[model samples]
Target: MSSHPILHANKTSPFGDLTPDEFYQKHQVLHTHSFISTNNKIKLYTQTWRPIAQSQAHPPCGVVAMIHGYASESGWVFETTAVAIAKLGFLVCAIDLPGHGRSEGPRGHIPSVTPVIDNCIQFFDEVRASNRHLPAFLYGESLGGAIAMFICLRQTGKWHGLVMNGAMCGVSRNFKPVWPLEKFLPAAAMLAPNWRVVVSGNLVDRSYKEKWKRELVRRCPRTKRVFEHPPASTALELLRVCEEVGRRCREVDLPLLVLHGEDDVVCDVESAELVYELAASTDKTLKVVPGMGHQLIGEGKEILEEGFEVIFSWLKGKIKK
Candidate 1:
């Protein structure tokens, strides 16, 4: 019921032209809400769900930070996942990254990875300052996962554990390689950064396919927004971050739970394997859910539930010991 301030200008595209009402109706099924962070210059829009039984008395379980993917806001993509994690007895803080969601920044422009990591650290500090007793964990999806890993490597002991779903360690198929191209492309594009490139070839999951079908019939234009198309220089910066993080995976020493779909087209499954193989943490696990696509958490209720159980069991075992 709380209002989330609209910050960025509504973009115009074949997929980005939906009226506010249509967008809200498409996502009305989930209990979506927002809050502003006092510590940062940006207005942080977050979605939170507590267990029904413990909504009044905050649960004793650890706090879990849910980081969302590129071009997508936390509200639109992470409602179901946040509810699932909260149902497992944890307080969840699912925030829109600086440029996404309702946060303050130019739409889709991530100047560098360091600033993103800094913002994440600030967000975590704000959360801890608000609620001190709950141990915090990192739950990142795709680009958010990559940001979480970077944070884990840079700041030690901040997180009790890490859960990454479809994390992007390196570029997937159809993305340009990061050798000589990486050295100059991002810098050059920044000067003339408004160029838009269509990123195609992403495979659709069944659930998303159905949702897209429904939205199409309803003429819901917002649901058609592409997260990565019209690639800006900032998008290239993200790719560079992925390349750097992929090399630094061995530096992660905390408990890690990595989930990826075998059929993911946005991120290569081998990237997950690489992280599992290189992470310094002995308490690491990788789960490959079958028939799922890039959006593993939103693919289906069954898959989402199963993934949550896996994460819950792991966290419970660790917390118990």
Candidate 2:
């Protein structure tokens, strides 16, 4: 691995004191591997962390289906949080979206969200089938949050609860493509779907609160690394998804927990609040923690733990019901 200080640091890792392999083994998290989506013959990368406390002899309290954000994979940094949930007696499963990480596609090029959502639903269905005795919840971050929202709407009763962290409910105006460029995005998408569309600033730098964490994330060789400018089609599709999600906010009627950083410029806190207010769900909670950014992992260790504490507590209460 590269000689980054964060990678080499002996500080108490959020991953725990043991080595990476040791921690995963202790947590009973299965090593990440590839699976065929069958929908489009695309090989997708998937990973699961099963609660050590629960087996055939014992039963899990619940299962969590996780979806990572845009330009992200389900392995590495994402797995850390999955392991945390598994430690709490829940089966946690995650999938890398197409065109991201180890999944096959033109990097960061999602012409439409339908295929991605369909792949996730198929994969999640398989997970739920295996653990039919347990309730299933959906967890997502950023674009993955949007996917989860769409899934819940399309497949009502498939999920018991939904947890969204820094979700793209509505793209912040500050981060959106400028007016003329936004107007021209559709034509450009039709003309050159795969062409890179550089935004005003890099998302990695803006999203992560810690500089080292950003660098560490960029060091991953499996992903496209640092220079991830969304493609024309991908950008246009994201805009459409945000708009559609906003329009359908009132349709969200399940138990919902929306966690967002108050300073998350990547996905506006205001948009998250709008969803919370508009959603018809009888039970809904929104926590906009102060002084945080889009990437919760980049927040200091204590705040990260605090965020998950809220998530786990909320999940536990829901599962008890």
User: Ten consecutive residues with minimal summed lDDT in candidate 1?
Assistant: 1-10
RMSD of each: 7.0, 3.9
What tens-digit string does per-residue lDDT give for candidate 2 at 211-300? 666766676666645236788888999999989889998999999999999888788889889988999999999988888788776777
TM-score of model 1 relative to the true fold? 0.77
Each model's TM-score, in the order given?
0.77, 0.92
- Candidate 1, residues 5-123: lDDT per residue as tens digits? 12111223112355444443333322446666545466766665555455346554777887877745566435445654565676677777776767777666666767777777776
Query: In angstroms, what RMSD does candidate 1 have relative to the true structure?
Result: 7.0
Which candidate number would show the highest TM-score if scored against the true structure?
2
By lDDT, the best candidate is: 2
